[model samples]
Target: MAETVFARTPRLVWRAGTPDDVEALYAIVSDFDVVRQTETWPWPADLSFTRSRCIVTASDQGASGVVCQGDEVVGYLGLSPEGKIGYMFGKFYWGRGLATEIGAAAVAYAFDRFDWQCLEACVFADNPASGRVLEKLGFEEGNACQGPCRARGGVYPIRTFRRPRA
Candidate 1:
């Protein structure tokens, strides 16, 4: 049997997402409330397992981990293909500091494993909670701009943040 290694926090575990995690991942991300602050996810997210599989399998470019509390997948955090930092947790897990913990771990992993000098993040102007997460993780706010938020089906103002590897 293969052993499963996990990145951990006081109350959560983080591990590389695999194809086996697709269902659990979909369950978390498919919740409209869970992704309402996101820029890319469609409101009625394409509930395709294949799409989820692609996300899990593409973690080779950067770090990607499923945030868990015991066996339940509560969220995910990772660097995107474009090298930006991103994360999302189940609505139930919000306000518990899980995103901040996961963000810290992912940032450390990215700096250790990749040659990138810095990582960037963008949060919708309306979602200050996410902006706070980035701030807590040492990401400094940068210029604001307008971006298409597929979930909202319109262009919305967004604020960008960046964290340089120390």
Candidate 2:
């Protein structure tokens, strides 16, 4: 299947992922450091688990795409049907400001493509860097909650952030 281009930044291209791209993505996501910051991606993630994410259908309710620099998959971005957005980048990409750049693009794309009252994101309380990114994109801190982390293998405190329609 042809990968659909979702959005692009000066340094990144946001596009639909394919099964062919799974191995590279898996390498990034399976890293303990990377997955620990995410609420959904499993630690020790297998190829099958990664493949399941790459296999997107047109009927899929929300955006699930790879963040690329030229041909390299640097990260993954997901915006669920429930309006929760999340992202994770490979270790090499950390501290690069790519997350905030891609995030701003994702926020614009979400509000433009869908009629949502706001876009929300869940940041693990420990991951203040992600919380900062959400804030950079105009999300304000909301209520706290707890959720299971597939990587952490337990529930973790979460800080919710939301960017309401202007």
Candidate 3:
């Protein structure tokens, strides 16, 4: 809930996520392709409104925002409670530069609105696209490690990245 109007890209608007957005949010994150590389999304995707509500509520407390394309919620860009930055978009929006737009908006918000000196992100080793999004936002590559990917149902290689406040 830092600021409702987080940022604006050419085709997308970044705004804070709200409880009412659960349905639209669910549509994006529930897609197997979207959550496959993530750490928290459940595998086989529960596809339940209850789960999406919980996620929206939790994200609402931090710098979480919905990525909108002309009045439609297309994705999410947010900072976790632990200060890590993450995003998810509907598969239809992929490869169209939406992630980069949202990522840059989230990075600016973190540095300008919060006291944290640095922000971190972790991308699955197999997900080079996500890694590129972080890199475009100025996140420097760091150590690589193994982490539990809930959707994958096993440990997966992860690449860590960090960006310090300017």
| C-alpha lDDT of all candidate models, in order | 0.77, 0.87, 0.79
Residue 60's lDDT within candidate 3 is 33
TM-score of every candidate: 0.87, 0.95, 0.86
Model 1 per-residue lDDT at 154: 89
Give the per-residue Cα lDDT of candidate 3 at 165: 89
**How do the candidates rank by TM-score, highest first?**
2, 1, 3
TM-score, candidate 1, is: 0.87
**Tens digits of lDDT, candidate 1, 36-100:** 77777677767674255324523457656677888888887767767798778889888988889
Runs of candidate 2 with Cα error greater than 4 angstroms are 57-60
User: Which candidate tops TM-score?
Assistant: 2
Mark the 10 consecutive residues where model 1 has the least summed lDDT: 49-58
Ten-residue stretch with the least lDDT total in model 3? 52-61
Q: Candidate 2 vs candidate 3: which has greater lDDT?
A: 2
Rank by lDDT, descending? Answer: 2, 3, 1
The digit string of per-residue lDDT tens for model 2 on 1-166 reads: 4569888999998888987789889999878999998877787887787888866532346888788999999999988998888899999999999999999898888888888899889988999999999999999999999988998899999999989987
RMSD of 2: 1.3
* lDDT by residue for model 3 (9-122), tens: 788887866666777877777787888878887856665642453345233335666889998989877787677998888899989999998788778877777778899999
